[model samples]
Target: MTNRAAGLLLFALISFAAPLQGQQAPAEAAQAAADQLEAATVALEAAESARDRVKALTGTVRAYEAGLGAMREGLRRVARRESQLLTQLKSREDDVAELLGILQTIETSAPPVLMLHPSGPLGAARSAMMVAEVTPGLYARAEALRRDLEEVQTLRLLQQNAAGTLEKGLSGVQEARTALSAAIADRTDLPRRFTENSVRTAILISSTETLTGFASGLAEIAGGAEKITPLSVDISAQRGELDLPVEGLLLRGFEKRDAAGIARPGLLIAARPRALVSTPTAATIRYRGPLLDLGNVVILEPQPDTLFILSGLAEVYGSAGQVIPAGTPVGLMGGSAPQAGAILSLSGEGGGTDRTETLYIEVRMDNSPVDPATWFRIGKGG
Candidate 1:
């Protein structure tokens, strides 16, 4: 072959060569992974226990929702592995025929017959040189096959684990949905602070200037000193212990810059569509309506002076001035579950609405924006 052709052929052969083998993860990465898995497992177990003990469906609903949130990290791990496994499987499939041919030749060839077939010294020398060239390729092919088999076994185990996880997640979601419906039905007689007129709400949405401005106006109209009772777990004391309102990857941290390069004083959570959002603490709904930039907004007061502003909802469930218990259903993010045969696309920083449902959470004390990362157990969505 010409030098260029030989180089190309060698490159093709190397493409199917044995992958450099080592521990699947580095020590640090593995440790971090273990920690995350442990956290997810703990959350799952807690949710299951809570669901079983709950006397009302409402409590079960919250537990189930929390379980789904916990499952997200595990699912994300599976998805990441799934991509890697696919690439490895494709490479092995591509090289299967070639590797089989090499194995067959090695298995059938007899050394004595090959040595006798070379009639002269020159012939033998040529044969030796040819043998020398082929030996390394044979070794490489054998190594590749061995690695491929090992990889296949690993992939099989991962697939089995993932299947079980997925089944549990699906079951949990179904039960949660059913329980939520029952809970809503049971609470049909619950009194509202004041009913919102759809016409006025729509008009307000159309006339709003900024999300913050609209929310500030609503707070003024709601008027008077805050009346909501304090939660049993003090907000300050529960720092870094607060649950996220929704299950999602933390796309943007407090004061992190967005796609427009503008830094915001809130967390942007990227979640799956229609993911249920629950209150992290007991709070009276200060405002629940749409804003100009934000799709739908719910401002809550966990304490008299502490405001939790949660925006980017597709549907708002609570009403203005209505007190909600901790873990109460607040609203929902836009989007449906990963549809059958549809791709589950992940998002990066500044995730858009098309692929991922994004929620914005901002905390304020005495009406000044504060970092929410300090208060919540922040983690990247699985």
Candidate 2:
């Protein structure tokens, strides 16, 4: 039999093996995987068709990036399932080899010929009895193999579809980047702001080694600048009642260590690509530009002491010192996947129903990073 056919049969036998410790029920796991795949597929379709709604090139990139993230997530889940299947198959090597031998023998002989083989009636009768004894087990194994084959086929199809979606998303991001670069080059008109010190800003950015350090330096600079806006709502009062700027899955929570073992104080939200990014509360734009490592950074001051540092954006809107209302559009997060220092949290804090665009939000008080989850109600619009 072919490797795939052998794999199916092995799955049948091993699926009946004892469940792995701490593993969820197979039905629950299967249902969850199905749900995730369906959600990712839907998000990808939406992203592919959503160019008209988001006219800005930055928004387009964000949307497509979100789609890519969803695709990656779906692929990861499929891989996990494949690994589990392989592990089960490996554990039952002897059983699988025996089954394959039986299949091979059956394929090589006709039923009538097998019944009349070797030493005639006596030997044939013994062989027939042995076959009959194992017939029930074979039937059960066959049924399981059939089910496994169908599931494997479905997963393969999903992987193919996700790869196609990712290719399209990458193309969208490329086109959007070209348009945005052109727009930036031809830029003439822009709003004025209190913290528009180009020379000092450049020096501070060059001096800082980390994003947090850069933010602290900027915060220090903003302290001396003229006040731009008065607080409209008490930021502290709205704790746990604030809505996210965009809707997507939460991949990591505040103070979580990333893949590199570096823990930053913030929440990483995986939103849909091209999804609108607004402020969770009324705030004044402190600064908006590309910082070291971060794609595009937008700093918002909802109150005198509280600064919201949002990074991983592709495009930013509003100007430094611009006072905007609550939920005002500030920028679009980058569409590109994160390279380092990002991983799903152990507690699984931010995994929402969707996985697409990733937006990082850092809350700081007096230049100290604070947990963003403590301020916003997760899994709800608020």
Model 1, residue 103: C-alpha shift (Å) = 4.8
**Which stretches in model 1 have alpha-carbon errors above 4 Å?**
1-106, 109-175, 178-182, 188-233, 255-264, 291-293, 320-323, 344-355
Among these predictions, the greatest lDDT belongs to 2
What would the TM-score be for candidate 1 when compared with the true structure? 0.58
Please give the lDDT score at residue 293 for candidate 1: 71
Question: What tens digits encode model 2's per-residue C-alpha lDDT throughout 1-382?
Answer: 2334435554545555543453333334434434444444444445445543223444544454454454445455565664566666677667666675776676687778768746678877866775655545666775565555565566556554444444545555555645545554444343434656677677888899887687667644453565444455566878878887776667788888899998878998876445557787778787889888877889888887788888877778767766666755676655543321232211112334334567898888888888888788788321
Worst 10 residues of 2 by lDDT: 339-348
Which lDDT tens digits does candidate 1 get at residues 177-209? 555544543454334444445565565566778
Q: At residue 367, give the lDDT of candidate 1.
A: 66
Per-residue lDDT, model 2, residue 237, is 79
